[model samples]
Target: MSAQDDVDDVGEFAALLRALKERTDRSYGSLARRLAMNTSTLHRYCAGEAVPVDFAPVERFAALCGATPEERLELHRRWLLAVAARRRPRTASAPEDEPDTAADPPPLPRRPWYRRRRVAVGLAAACALLATLASLSVLPDGRRPAADRAPTAGPLASGTTEAKAPDRSSPSPTPSDSPATEQPSASATPKKKPSPAPSARTTAPPRSGRKPAAVPLTWSANSQAWKLGCGHDYVIAKPPRQVPPPPAPQDAGTWAATQGAVHGGETLVELSVQGRSDTAVVLNALRVRVVGRTAPAPGNAYAMDQGCGGAVTPRSFDVNLDKDRPIAHAVAGSDTGVPIPAVRMPYRVSAEDPEVLLVTARTVTCDCLWYLELDWSSQGRRGTVRIDDAGHPFRTSGIKGLPQYTYDTLARQWTPDS
Candidate 1:
């Protein structure tokens, strides 16, 4: 079948799965064996004949196929849509010979003539009694009768004159002339009711001095350009010639993720931090925490960009990953010519005003698995937030002696980095 026919048959989610699998150039049996799944079941997933009960298997499959982060997100979105469609109920047509039971409602039971007449007479008498009571309760001017109104109290015994009862024959006093204790006229504007006090259950408690379980700060990581016009370097298993051309600036992360790349030598991570609420958060310090250390993975280093020009003077920091206890030191910008002062911590961030921290983590001795801990304080509460790649520690490796490659725009191919 044609590719278009297959897509129509299986669906968007399955089509994406098939495409990612094809890009890896591995047989279904080989990939399925690695995934620890039945080869036929894997084929069913790719063919759109079936969907996995959970996203875990799908995510694993995508990771094995080297699908980019962007592609994986898209895959997830399409999977949700497919799942919803599968669960949606389908309308079925009735058989032509079947009776149309719902076409007409069941007829109501009929009453005898004498019984119906008796019910009508009883309803009329009750309605008439209600009308008479309503007429007697309200006066012609919309005031209640004197007998129906609450009795007013006499004057208090402080040598004050006793209060006299209102004359029954006289019309009720206008709102302006009415006594303070009297009800206001119906035509007068109604008074607004005071709002009720909030209950303890509904009221939010004040922020305490105790630290919260989670920090209020939120951040995102992106691969940023380094000094001397060099962009991010990733170590991939593929040779220079076999790797694809350089990706655009915005697509750098997706490209790196798709190539199953690892940071080479140094990785410049741009951390965008902002408070989760309108309340400002103070960033006290950032500490590097190494999770694991091992020999650098063997692979060829590919630079995302080479020989590009331009410099950016942002709030930047430097960390030597080789140290047992690495500290992020505030650093001056490189290639900007002017001596820019390093921006020390104690930064403030809010929902509206965010802070960006450019960190250059370098390693020359060993491959490192590390993350950052940002100490922040806001509203009398202080806590530390763990920063990593999604939920995993960021990985970087030393590439001192590894072969390096860069894409050649003119040759339309990857060439050895000069």
Candidate 2:
């Protein structure tokens, strides 16, 4: 059957996988080869017959097909749902109106001959003891013996002897001296100590307190400067010819570090945050901290993507570094340049539901060294996570009227952008 037909049988996850695969216009064998998996397994995943154990394969497949970040996030959501569904137990359906026909219970097993004999012997001994007690008490008369009767509180008649009360102060009688019918003294009986009460720590649920140094939220931040249609650019002291062609998006961070590049004109910081556990984390705020400000660095700007058309605009916040105190303001719409009334704070994220914040800090006056602090709370624990460019503050400077260059596809060299 076709992938679409299989998707109809399975669910939305398979449908999305098939759609992404179809967009690439590649056969299962070719895609599977690139993904380093068996074609049949890939087919099963796309056809909804099976789900991948790990999301790594699914993400690699999406990247191979050039899925947008938003699409990748949606795919991750669907994958999480699929995983949950697979784990949930299914109960058998039954008609509530109909009464169940009870089956006959199995017969009890017979006791061993030796065990039955032992029980019979015990019963006989009990019967003999009861007969002996009756014979001793009756004395061939219908009345019970005087010793066997309960003592009366009234005074005794002239011919009758008075009963004496036992003295609690005296030592307990020996077992041989005590009457067979008498119970042991209360003092002689061993008292049981009450079981110790369970400890509060063991019985009660754990109390909420300050979490450890490691917060439950996991995050990564990347700083890049974009111009025109280019996603990331760098300002380096060396000329354009001295630098190699721009690296792929995944390698952009390392490439920038290697070239000793700094952000020019504007710096876009992308922060990806997700919870380490299944519990949801509330992102309280994203605050900016300016480390220092200096004059713009002297360098020529180089664009990563020269001829690429347009760029993907994610939900972003704008920060103007020229102000004494810069705050992140949420943008209303893509390319609208309208700031929302309030920042997008108090957002929820989880292992399954992640969040990405695009922060664009622009400056025309001074070079700024800045970093972000993300406040988050989860399960009653609140903390702040420092976001930076690989353990260092992100540096962005104004490039007003400085030399700017773009790679020319036709010339196979860097050419000045008009």
Candidate 3:
């Protein structure tokens, strides 16, 4: 299907996912781990703000939710319809009772009293009376207005001179002066040189001061933990995914250097704690540092707060290179990347929350990717940190443009890196 079709399918695709999620009754965090993605990202998919790019994730998610094979087929069918609808023209038919404004109305003939015979006769008499009065004004016009005849030869392009209102800028020319005015000389030098072209410093004011609640990234010194304060961004936190599947070890370097650098791509720095299912993993701190510069790595962003209005938002950290960043940073603004300062892991999954290690590696360029390495110092028990799933150091986009040199996971194509 076309790219447009995929975007349009967001709503229906999201609805099905929402229902599937409820059927499983799981938390976003649990599900993300199960799906190998971020809890925040899964929320976006289910909220209709974004659609699943890879059917693999969707299929796996469905199976985890215990969706019957037939039900899964229906999900796929609806997904296809939603995507197809996107490509379909939104033109709607007009109501049968409504008039079609496209057609022109018949022209009306202009008729009035001034065009009638009686009115015409009355007008002629009035003109004759005005002429007689004029001829008699002050004894045949005391100095018979000096022959108002216009001069035929003059500098004026249209030579026949006519009466003109005097210009207010300068005193009216004395009658003795020659009527012809001289045009400027070609020898005269040019006036002020056009101001130099504006510099790059002049940019559309950076989008700021307009903040829809930030993801209340809180750091409680006493607790030594990061907490997501209650806000619209996290109103109803979708349960974490079902028991997570085995990890698919991806090469952070190969993935980031090739795919993460796409001009309009997205990268997610997902987190997975090291612990048992019932253990509550508290995050200490994570930094998105720019250690080196890589060629062609321009500004990009991490997708957040798109639809997180009142409920707990998904925790899947996604980066959309196409979206603008919130702040004015040197490399990429909000799109540049996210800096989840020292935050406490305040969310608890279950009674058996055990510490788990998030596997990660040196992924893509700092400019295009946000590799989050967690700190386990604050946890009651040092939780193992693993970083292989969703929101890894580097993740691909749902949809990507024709890549000049970057890899497009959707297309499974790219201009092989040098």
Among the numbered candidates, top TM-score falls to 2
TM-score against native, each model: 0.48, 0.48, 0.24
Task: Name the 10 consecutive residues with the lowest summed lDDT in model 3.
Answer: 151-160
Clashes of 2: 0
Give a tens-digit lDDT track for model 3, residues 240-325.
12111111111111211222222123222223232222334455544332212222222222111222222222222222232333
Better of 2 and 3 by TM-score: 2
Model 1 C-alpha lDDT per residue in residues 103-178, reported as the tens digit of each score = 2111212222111100000010111110000001111223233234221110000100101122335444343322
Best candidate according to lDDT: 1
lDDT of 2 at 376: 75
Measured on C-alpha atoms, candidate 1 has an lDDT of: 0.52
Please state the error at residue 41 of candidate 1 in Å: 47
What TM-score does structure 1 among the candidates reach?
0.48
Whose TM-score is higher: candidate 1's or candidate 3's?
1
